[model samples]
Target: MTTASPRWFKSSYSGTTSNCVEVAINLVASHGTVPVRDSKVSDGPSFSVSASAFSSFVAGVKGGRLGV
Candidate 1:
């Protein structure tokens, strides 16, 4: 079976820097997870976390609970 490829994108608030991460939300429906990877290394390793968990992480970042 062929696997779906991630449509990766970084946050709009992310500046043009090498320190940002890219995420693909496209798999949430099909895979129930969000894939994340380093923007500086597109061909490097990538991993996925549950949708709810990813949402919580984003919320924490926005709420300043993540401390950057």
Candidate 2:
């Protein structure tokens, strides 16, 4: 089963065609889990990650670990 309805928030820096995916804002502290999905596929498959893992992912993004 899927986690939840697909909702998204594009990065402010992303432009048209937005290669970056927008994350679901609904899965905040209450769930203690961060949910992420593709903006183009609203009802598509999504994955959930631990808050700490999510934090690390964000750090990697900022640190250029993912190479943008």
Best by lDDT: 1
Candidate 2, position 24, lDDT? 67
lDDT of 1 by residue, 1-68 (tens): 33888999998778877789999999998899999999999999999999999999989978999765
TM-score of each: 0.87, 0.71
RMSD (Å) per prediction: 1.7, 3.7
lDDT of each: 0.92, 0.74
Model 2 TM-score relative to the real fold: 0.71
Local error of candidate 2 at residue 8 (angstroms):
2.5
For model 1, what is the error of residue 65's alpha carbon versus the real structure, in angstroms, after optimal superposition?
1.6
Global CA lDDT computed for model 2: 0.74
Q: Give candidate 1's error at residue 48 in angstroms.
A: 0.5
